[model samples]
Target chain A: MSSSTTPALPMHEVRAEATWLQRNKMIVTPLLFLLPGMLFFAVYVIFPIFQSFGISLYRWDGLGEATYIGLANYEELLTDRNFEISLVNNLKWLVLYLLAIPLGLFIALFLNQTVMGIRLYKSLFFFPFVLSQVVVGLVFSWFYLPREGLLNTIITGLGFDSLNILGDPTLATYGIIAAGLWPQTAYCMILYLTGLNAVDPEQVEAGRLDGAKGWKMLWYVILPQLKPATFIAFVVTIIGALRSFDLISVMTNGGPFGSTRVLSFYMFERALSEFGFRMGYGSAIAVVLFLIMLVFIGYFLWQMWRDEREARRG
Target chain B: MFPTPIEKRSRAAQITYQSLLPLALILWLLPLIAVMVFSIRPFSDFTQGNYWGVPSSFELFTNYGMVFFESDMPRYLLNSVFITVPTVIGAVALSCMTGFALGIYRFRGNLLIFFMFIAGNFVPFQILMVPVRDLTVDMGLYDTKLGLILFHVAFQTGFCTLFMRNFIRALPYELIEAARVEGVAEWRIFWFVVLPLMRPAIAALSVLIFTFIWNDYFWAIVLTQGPDAQPVTAGITSFNSQFVAQYHLMSAGSIVAAIPPVAIFFLMQRHFIAGLTLGAVK
Candidate 1:
């Protein structure tokens, strides 16, 4: 109103004279825009995290809960053989899953060439990553079927005895990990392939001039430039390792007497599975997994924070 | 370029590289190829112990028809479509606003909020399982597609926000500034200026989220049940349980379930990879 009468009024004065909501548009607009997403996120993702933590302190079934068991769930974890096995298996997953990055890098290096049908090869190599993990798990399970399965068929053709990959307790976790790695390695390979495209050809040529060929050239010249890709690969690989559920869910269901159980699957089996709805025990297990993820999450955030600072400086 | 590019190598080396390429690809896709082969094989082949032999007769249509017409696969596929399309729209719509707010505005707690989305995304789903299910049940939405859709929309927002924020942040700030100087409304600045610039990001994210939500299995089992609400992944798993020995039919079902994502990936191959590796190269 004041701006209409006073035509010479500056923009700021007009903005100030506007409605209160208009005057505070910057703060109000962002909050207005953020409201719906934040509400849903808080309700579904954020709050449940704490809710799960609180439920961990008690021993309540999902329905009609009224029992405060005060750390009994966590205490039980210390002696729980199942939890112990799951943790060990998860550790194995984390360690073995790292192989994907290097394996992926190797394939990427092998295929990064100007050749016929290279693009087709790249897409085909990425085929596994596109399929549902359910399908991958099923396919691998079929592959590992005793005598009739493809893997065993090949093994028997070579005069080796058949192995029930998903049936053997000792080897079941490894089988599932191998299946998981198929798609994971494809994912990392794509990342590295994209990273390879961004590498400075000039630096690589200079390194070759300095007699850095073969692995030496890759290590000294190329690898440094691929740090971003390597970091992402590790992040994704590690996260995938911890969250190894679908394959286990589809292929084995933590079976052969739960030898292949990882924390994520174990959490589900305890809390939501047909056996029982031990919500508190499962939440406790989930809390443990959350803390484990927090270590990597911290490192990721710290690295990103440092990168942000550098970006700001530049 | 990092490798020796094979052309400069000796003839023997080049020949070996060329031959080995197909061999490696075949080995890598052996499982998928096996599944495809099984999909076309007649069930009589499996009954007669011809699992590894050549198909007695190609029954591609018969197998796929059974999966589509005889089984509950069609309903499950429809459930997936219903759940996924809405989720893609909801998550993308939510993130566009949140991404604009966080990406364009310099505000207190901006990093905190954005990182919350990132951290929430990385946290395992196990933590949210019990309560979210309970919450859905309490709301009388358990076993409903809407319940699953709502949960997915919320859960995926964590990821979609991180994606959109980075995308919108990379857009030229001058466009937004110029709009503001022209006295355009703030929402109009978003609707007309930044939103138009976000087309590629939207396409990429839509394809990515479509794949993610379509491929989801955990929450499908957690929140929904039966052919009424369960997606193809969970449904297919249940189907596997029912017909544990029917590899041919199972393979056909898997092929049916795999078509949408595989088609999307091939059609939008560039966008799919771009979305997957968005943060990696940078």
Candidate 2:
């Protein structure tokens, strides 16, 4: 109002001179800004989800006439041995992958000191998380190679039998999960390291004065401060566990009797691999994964919403 | 501080802690160290069954040279650059607008839209795979780098928006309000006032998104094929098949494939960690 040139102009003329867009710039501007992003997101991310649900109801190859299957793909999943293995493997991934959080907290506690060269050590220990999962998988596969591998060399040197980890069905999933855990532990470590940086000195001093130390101090004082980090670590770890396709694709290719196949890898195989493009079946598998993810997604969103509310109230 | 600083400990304990740091680091990075050692060794050592021994010959240059000069590794790397750069720019650009709108405004459905981006980001990629592939093919974009970039930009927008909006929100709102009171256009405020302050966030998101798009393997395979358009992550598979059982060359190829993002992380460590640990503390 102060910037208006004709401060003495009639109020009716001033109001008439303002265009609709000018009058509603607050609403118009945000809507205009949101347009392109919303369009792309809806087209590529949001709509695809509902489309997958719809696609799961019909049998359609990539280049063929569609046949409405109406949950038949899901019916097959009920009896499909591969699907069973994939689901169970997914569960194993969810459970085992979570070990990264506590393990990460441990490493963070160890590295939280103010030693010289600690920065380099911290980055080096966090190195694995920066490398691509594909590279990690390749490195581990070579490490686990049967005859000339380093792992076997060490085992034999220690007078223990050399084990072909990826070649055995029972061990393959665990082997791949171990590989997955390397980067994941590094990721969680970084989160906790950041969390530990912000821990209040006064609280630590108080805890010390109260005779808290080691595990007791950590459980009572440090862990509470690390809750935000733990929450994020949990979210990322669970998502990483479900999104276990790249490592499996690179290392095992769902091999060793398909024991390492998770829902993600199985969905890809069903949808596009040479085994036959069963798009509907793949869609069905994807829907199941999405539903599982939705549970966690809902929880994360609810937490964020609660935080947002608290921020508003405070 | 929680672990008790080494300075406060006894001298022997201090020495032990310092010595144990390196030992623990070596153990933590053993697998990667093994690969680095593998990459530098000559093929003669592998043939002589001298694996894990001191390299009979250091062939670092020779092996990486073959990857660059004699294979499709160069093409794949270039493709990776093309794919990653555009996706980073596109996602960051779009999210900046979305984040600005969501951050600055008090419009209806703002939180709803914000939650949508968050939820979409957390959905498994497989749920979006088939339809996105179909949509790409429908637009005659499959088997093209553009197809991959378009989809990556869209999907990553979810996460980017989440990061960006939160970053924008943390900025002082008074600047925007002051700009508005001064009769500055909304778009001008976004461009001048908000965007200037968003440099650190932009830098962080760019580095984070660069690593993500560069390391993307599943989409590379799903969207493109062969050396023509496939990024290094997908092309590494073929690179491996071409040099099967040639451990030295394969290791070199893998190292080459992994270098760019690792390099970026080291170069921009501050921003990278800031982007990653955005909400971990606060």
Candidate 3:
């Protein structure tokens, strides 16, 4: 995504000013520009990453003196049933959360036309993505409210029954995820819709000429072109799954006996909430989550690096 | 274009598409629509088992007024504004310079620094929770709006820098080159030549950050507590616990909390989408 094709600072211009400032321009200038953002980024982002890992190796409450407890936090995480549950729930989230991509693509394909009021439809469809997940969680909570909730009302009206979805340990995570997928699918749809708009018309026509249409055309001709959108969708979906904090916090509070707890919420419960301020344990969970995220981040950066290099070569 | 235009299809197909469009949209937005309608109805309706009926009387003004006056919603909303507006300005301001530095220059660590910002933007917030909270407490920033604002600005710079550097990179380098040739100071070149051309990027980022910061709920919980400095997102969660079964008031409060971002999305839809779908289309 590097922007400039033509680099500035042509050779002749470098010698125009013999002053010390101009002589040292390249080194001094960029640093001067970068200082403020780097200062903040280092203190809040970079430094804390290492510090979090350091804290993970200690046995300390948030209050007092720290004691080194090497690997205890991580070792405990191995046997902790709640940690196991949260880890398993996270895996479930990653798998079920992937449904957003195809669901979004289906909606994108459904709505990717020049019909009347299509723009309104597009914006409305994407409206949920704009609202806070807190609101989404609340709305769904109300929608799933035991007997009088919409889900139960409809079920009871049909001579059936409904369960307290948010209160059921087995069903809770899936219930929260259903609420989550509503906005996530909308997000993915918008990405694919944009990708679809930019697909090559000539290639589509060429595919038609070769007797390609429908699923054949989409698979062979169009899906390849939508690779960028798919990659972004995958990246966001996976990250969103990992960062599944706000929804769980709002909907269940890792409730129904902590069945819905992802690493994020569980870490918060251990470190910050009323459970106890076990900073070491919280940071240990965080470090594990960070390692998981690093794998994805490293992959994404490598892909971008290769592409940037390939761009110059091509 | 991929599936072939539905316009050229049969009349029945066109009618089906048109009808299904709204139906699908309504079905998709059912939970939200239910909440929106519930927000304006009187509390009597919820108590009387009128969950999905037309309101006996519209309490739009009453509900919203209560949210503003009878509750801490106003304070929470104000806290959101105080925290969000400054973070947007600070982050965008800093990123403009960082983006300029990394985007235009071919320094020793240009790609390294750029990659750092890109990678840092994706780190889990929980990873920063313990140490960041400790840092804020050490600075006397715990449970304060300024603390939240500073933290948000710093954290957001990673993303804003990514947005801005790419934005600046797309601008013509010739403009900067010409300014340099005229013996203009480097900072002057950035301010006069580059900054004016970056208005669209600034607009895109300003709106994008506005929505991102406004909709942030996790940090609001991790950093601040109570109505004193808690933003509306976290405040609403507190409201949920206090006002159990009071769905009308909760619904009203939710709408109030959601208004700013929704309004921004409508007003600056173009820039918001442009910023969000930056690389999606290739």
Candidate 4:
């Protein structure tokens, strides 16, 4: 009966001699194969998402008896100063983090040449992305150390007062973003490199013959062909920007004056930190963030669905 | 091809380009280079403010030795290995089966299920945090390596499934059709025909997942705590506080924590890149 749906398989002759399991293998097999993964994913990933939304409507310490306080957690978010700061910073992150795409393209273009040991150079440029964000955060924190850091060493040597980037509230977020871009740009560069590798040589030659050169060639001819790569680069960069938790956690811990608190770090601080166990409040923050991310996720899925449809047709 | 090859350029431009490449690389990696230098220096150099100068003495072994034996760094590292390895194995294993099921079957809700995995993979960790932590504690697995491992595996499966299913889809349909024509059992076909052909995807996903799980700081902290279960990413925080104001030790510890993924990446460079840029071409 299950084999009826599997158009790719023809089991008519074998069906008469087979057991129920073998006859229903197409459906049963996939269901059996999907069960463990789906169960685990549902238990760990899927259910928790809805549970978080449910939990957000109630005020409960994680361990204590819960009290339903419908929408209070979210109402508080409206007036919360830190929430405002975090929201603005998230916008800042969203906009600035995209710089990695063009920056990555620039680097990829720079190193796209076939020279001696260029492969090694490409790998070296991509080095920062391989390291954990914890490590990257640590390294950058040290790099921003006012007195002992390399940045200041160069600054002081150049007859200027050494600046404390991370300690300043206004500059701290940008400081972290710059550290983030180091790896993110590297990631984007690799994407573009791979994209550039697949670019049609004939079209490039045609454009060149028609008097396209330098930026004009890149903008008119190459960029259109690199659309898939740019799309991916856009998706990952957006995700990376929003998922900027580890670096902030390590660098400032929502520091100097609670200036660097994005929704992610702030949510953790409320829910789990020594300040208090405001699980409901944290969940509300997470929900807002989830909503923001949903926009991008929906866009990505629609694009993918379109591509999948195209692939099936073509 | 897009930029016109350097061989097509002038001689002076070529020499200048060659010189700029290394210089740009050095500048780009300067922060990491500084950390490497700091890891090799004695504490005296930092105290004396000799940061940019030549190290007064190289104490690489001593600092790293302290991190290994004197601190809980070794335990944290071992926990990271235990947590990461199992998660990699479990996630990859589950996804291979899931990927095969989703990729090959023409069932109702196939695209829906595939989209579920993809969308879940993109969700923020914070959304899953409060409940996942609660769930772990209720199961009496909190602050244990196994707790971290289970959560990592489940979370990572979303991604691994997306990767593996696409890889399986790209495999020749004729191969599976031919196997079906030979009257092979479905499971037998998966095991004998598809699984063997999936070796490259398996290898690529292994290294990719290893790097991701190893570098995962968010879940490590949320699901576990302390040296007993915390991976190196979290452990490095405690290690830093222990050696607070001890820049040399912190540098050595971070470098040690970062080495595994970096080594794996360098060794499996081709497979690593292949896994990363999977859909970029299309």
TM-score winner: 4
* TM-score for each of the candidates: 0.97, 0.97, 0.96, 0.98
Model number with the top lDDT: 4
Candidate 1, B1-282: lDDT as tens digits: 788778899999999999999999999999889888988998788878887887889899998888888888889999999999999999999999999999987667788999999899999999999889989999999999999999999989999999999999899888887777777888999999999999999999999999999999999999998989999999997777666788988998898998899899999999999999997777
Candidate 2 lands at a TM-score of 0.97
Candidate 3: where is the Cα deviation over 4 Å?
A1-17
Candidate 3 positional error at A3, Å: 21
Candidate 3 on A173-208: residue-level lDDT in tens?
Answer: 999999999989999999999999999999999999
> What are the per-residue Cα lDDT tens digits for candidate 4 across B97-166?
9999999887778899999999999999999999999999999999998888888899889999999999
Candidate-wise lDDT, in order: 0.91, 0.92, 0.90, 0.92
Model 4 clashing residue pairs (backbone): none
Candidate 1, residues A1-314, lDDT tens digits: the string is 22322222136554436776666677778889999999999999999999999999988887785599898999999999999999999999999999999999999998899899999999999988888999899899988999668899899999989999899999999999999999999999999999999988899889888999998998988999999999999999999999999999888989999899999999999998787989999999999999999999999988988887787688
Sort order, lDDT high to low: 4, 2, 1, 3
Question: Candidate 4 deviates by what RMSD?
Answer: 1.5
Pairs of residues clashing in candidate 3 = none
For all candidates, state DockQ relative to the true structure: 0.62, 0.64, 0.64, 0.74
Instruction: Using DockQ as the measure, name the better of candidate 1 and candidate 3.
Output: 3
For chain B alone, what TM-score does every candidate structure achieve against the true structure? 0.97, 0.99, 0.96, 0.98
Per-residue accuracy of model 2 over A121-201 as CA lDDT, tens digit each: 999989899899999999999999988778888899999998999999999999999999999999999999999999999
Which residue window of length 10 is worst by lDDT in model 4 chain B? Answer: B220-229
DockQ-derived CAPRI band for the predicted complex in model 4? medium
